[model samples]
Target: MPESRRRKAAVQKKRAQENVEIEKNRELKGSPRWWAPLMVGLMLLGLIIVVTAYVTGGNYPIGFDNGNYNLFLGFGVMLVGFLMTMGWK
Candidate 1:
Protein backbone atom coordinates (compact mmCIF):
# COMPACT_ATOMS: atom_id res chain seq x y z
CA MET A 1 0.00 0.00 0.00
CA PRO A 2 1.10 3.60 -0.57
CA GLU A 3 2.43 5.51 2.43
CA SER A 4 -0.58 7.90 2.43
CA ARG A 5 -3.02 5.02 2.16
CA ARG A 6 -1.28 3.18 4.98
CA ARG A 7 -1.42 6.23 7.19
CA LYS A 8 -5.10 6.76 6.42
CA ALA A 9 -5.86 3.14 7.17
CA ALA A 10 -4.00 3.35 10.46
CA VAL A 11 -5.88 6.47 11.44
CA GLN A 12 -9.22 4.89 10.61
CA LYS A 13 -8.36 1.80 12.58
CA LYS A 14 -7.33 3.86 15.56
CA ARG A 15 -10.57 5.84 15.40
CA ALA A 16 -12.62 2.67 15.21
CA GLN A 17 -10.83 1.23 18.20
CA GLU A 18 -11.37 4.43 20.13
CA ASN A 19 -15.07 4.38 19.31
CA VAL A 20 -15.38 0.81 20.47
CA GLU A 21 -13.65 1.63 23.72
CA ILE A 22 -15.91 4.62 24.26
CA GLU A 23 -19.00 2.48 23.72
CA LYS A 24 -17.78 -0.14 26.11
CA ASN A 25 -17.08 2.44 28.75
CA ARG A 26 -20.49 3.98 28.25
CA GLU A 27 -22.15 0.64 28.76
CA LEU A 28 -20.12 -0.12 31.83
CA LYS A 29 -20.87 3.28 33.38
CA GLY A 30 -24.56 3.22 32.60
CA SER A 31 -26.71 3.29 35.73
CA PRO A 32 -30.39 3.66 36.48
CA ARG A 33 -31.52 7.20 37.21
CA TRP A 34 -32.94 6.16 40.53
CA TRP A 35 -29.99 4.10 41.71
CA ALA A 36 -28.03 6.79 43.50
CA PRO A 37 -31.06 8.41 45.04
CA LEU A 38 -32.38 5.10 46.25
CA MET A 39 -29.06 4.19 47.77
CA VAL A 40 -28.82 7.52 49.59
CA GLY A 41 -32.40 7.21 50.78
CA LEU A 42 -31.75 3.75 52.10
CA MET A 43 -28.73 4.97 54.00
CA LEU A 44 -30.65 7.90 55.45
CA LEU A 45 -33.59 5.72 56.41
CA GLY A 46 -31.28 3.33 58.18
CA LEU A 47 -29.61 6.11 60.06
CA ILE A 48 -32.95 7.53 61.09
CA ILE A 49 -34.18 4.17 62.28
CA VAL A 50 -31.06 3.62 64.32
CA VAL A 51 -31.18 7.06 65.86
CA THR A 52 -34.88 6.75 66.60
CA ALA A 53 -34.44 3.42 68.28
CA TYR A 54 -31.67 4.76 70.40
CA VAL A 55 -33.57 7.89 71.31
CA THR A 56 -36.68 5.93 72.16
CA GLY A 57 -34.82 3.68 74.53
CA GLY A 58 -34.84 0.74 72.14
CA ASN A 59 -38.58 0.44 72.30
CA TYR A 60 -40.57 -1.21 69.57
CA PRO A 61 -41.41 1.70 67.30
CA ILE A 62 -43.27 -0.58 64.92
CA GLY A 63 -45.62 -1.92 67.59
CA PHE A 64 -43.55 -5.01 68.32
CA ASP A 65 -42.21 -5.73 71.78
CA ASN A 66 -38.83 -7.11 70.85
CA GLY A 67 -36.48 -5.49 73.31
CA ASN A 68 -33.41 -4.60 71.19
CA TYR A 69 -34.60 -5.83 67.85
CA ASN A 70 -35.09 -2.32 66.59
CA LEU A 71 -31.43 -1.51 67.09
CA PHE A 72 -30.33 -4.67 65.33
CA LEU A 73 -32.80 -4.12 62.55
CA GLY A 74 -31.56 -0.59 62.04
CA PHE A 75 -27.96 -1.74 62.01
CA GLY A 76 -28.81 -4.47 59.51
CA VAL A 77 -30.58 -2.02 57.24
CA MET A 78 -27.68 0.43 57.47
CA LEU A 79 -25.19 -2.29 56.67
CA VAL A 80 -27.19 -3.25 53.58
CA GLY A 81 -27.24 0.36 52.48
CA PHE A 82 -23.50 0.62 52.99
CA LEU A 83 -23.01 -2.49 50.92
CA MET A 84 -25.17 -1.12 48.15
CA THR A 85 -23.02 1.99 48.02
CA MET A 86 -20.07 -0.14 46.95
CA GLY A 87 -21.88 -0.86 43.71
CA TRP A 88 -22.33 2.83 42.94
CA LYS A 89 -20.01 4.44 40.46
Candidate 2:
Protein backbone atom coordinates (compact mmCIF):
# COMPACT_ATOMS: atom_id res chain seq x y z
CA MET A 1 0.00 0.00 0.00
CA PRO A 2 1.06 3.61 -0.52
CA GLU A 3 2.60 5.46 2.47
CA SER A 4 -0.34 7.95 2.66
CA ARG A 5 -2.91 5.15 2.60
CA ARG A 6 -1.06 3.24 5.33
CA ARG A 7 -0.99 6.33 7.57
CA LYS A 8 -4.69 6.96 7.00
CA ALA A 9 -5.54 3.38 7.87
CA ALA A 10 -3.48 3.53 11.05
CA VAL A 11 -5.22 6.74 12.12
CA GLN A 12 -8.64 5.27 11.54
CA LYS A 13 -7.75 2.12 13.47
CA LYS A 14 -6.50 4.17 16.41
CA ARG A 15 -9.68 6.27 16.44
CA ALA A 16 -11.87 3.16 16.40
CA GLN A 17 -9.94 1.65 19.30
CA GLU A 18 -10.27 4.88 21.27
CA ASN A 19 -14.00 4.98 20.70
CA VAL A 20 -14.38 1.42 21.93
CA GLU A 21 -12.44 2.17 25.06
CA ILE A 22 -14.57 5.25 25.76
CA GLU A 23 -17.76 3.23 25.46
CA LYS A 24 -16.44 0.53 27.80
CA ASN A 25 -15.58 3.12 30.43
CA ARG A 26 -19.02 4.69 30.12
CA GLU A 27 -20.63 1.34 30.74
CA LEU A 28 -18.56 0.73 33.88
CA LYS A 29 -19.40 4.08 35.44
CA GLY A 30 -21.88 3.94 38.38
CA SER A 31 -25.43 5.24 38.56
CA PRO A 32 -25.50 8.71 40.15
CA ARG A 33 -29.22 8.88 40.95
CA TRP A 34 -29.89 5.89 43.19
CA TRP A 35 -26.93 4.65 45.23
CA ALA A 36 -25.62 7.99 46.48
CA PRO A 37 -28.73 9.23 48.22
CA LEU A 38 -29.60 5.80 49.51
CA MET A 39 -26.18 5.40 51.05
CA VAL A 40 -26.32 8.81 52.69
CA GLY A 41 -29.77 8.16 54.09
CA LEU A 42 -28.70 4.86 55.53
CA MET A 43 -25.76 6.41 57.27
CA LEU A 44 -27.84 9.22 58.67
CA LEU A 45 -30.56 6.91 59.89
CA GLY A 46 -27.98 4.71 61.55
CA LEU A 47 -26.49 7.64 63.35
CA ILE A 48 -29.90 8.81 64.53
CA ILE A 49 -30.79 5.39 65.85
CA VAL A 50 -27.52 5.17 67.72
CA VAL A 51 -27.97 8.56 69.34
CA THR A 52 -31.57 7.98 70.23
CA ALA A 53 -30.76 4.65 71.78
CA TYR A 54 -27.97 6.15 73.81
CA VAL A 55 -30.04 9.08 75.05
CA THR A 56 -33.05 6.94 75.98
CA GLY A 57 -31.07 4.38 77.95
CA GLY A 58 -32.23 1.73 75.47
CA ASN A 59 -35.79 1.99 76.75
CA TYR A 60 -37.16 2.91 73.35
CA PRO A 61 -39.85 0.71 71.86
CA ILE A 62 -37.71 -0.02 68.85
CA GLY A 63 -35.24 -1.92 70.99
CA PHE A 64 -38.01 -4.14 72.36
CA ASP A 65 -36.56 -5.32 75.68
CA ASN A 66 -32.80 -5.37 75.14
CA GLY A 67 -30.77 -2.21 75.57
CA ASN A 68 -28.00 -3.53 73.35
CA TYR A 69 -30.31 -4.29 70.46
CA ASN A 70 -30.42 -0.71 69.23
CA LEU A 71 -26.66 -0.48 69.32
CA PHE A 72 -26.28 -3.56 67.15
CA LEU A 73 -29.04 -2.47 64.82
CA GLY A 74 -27.43 0.93 64.36
CA PHE A 75 -24.06 -0.60 63.58
CA GLY A 76 -25.66 -2.98 61.11
CA VAL A 77 -27.36 -0.11 59.35
CA MET A 78 -24.11 1.83 59.20
CA LEU A 79 -22.34 -1.20 57.76
CA VAL A 80 -24.95 -1.49 55.03
CA GLY A 81 -24.36 2.14 54.19
CA PHE A 82 -20.64 1.56 53.94
CA LEU A 83 -21.19 -1.37 51.64
CA MET A 84 -23.53 0.64 49.46
CA THR A 85 -20.86 3.32 49.06
CA MET A 86 -18.71 0.85 47.16
CA GLY A 87 -21.28 0.89 44.36
CA TRP A 88 -21.45 4.70 44.21
CA LYS A 89 -19.45 6.48 41.53
Highest-TM-score candidate = 2
- The residue pairs in collision within model 1 are none
Judge candidate 1 at residue 59 and give its lDDT: 76
Clashes of each: 0, 0
lDDT of each: 0.80, 0.87
For residue 79, give model 1's deviation from the true position in Å.
Answer: 1.3
Q: Using Cα atoms with residue i matched to residue i, what is each candidate's TM-score against the true structure?
A: 0.63, 0.68
Q: Which stretches of candidate 1 lie over 4 Å from their true place?
A: 1-28
Scored against the true structure, residue 25 in model 1 reaches a CA lDDT of 89
Per residue, candidate 1 scores C-alpha lDDT tens digits across 9-49 of 99999999999999998878856788888888888888888
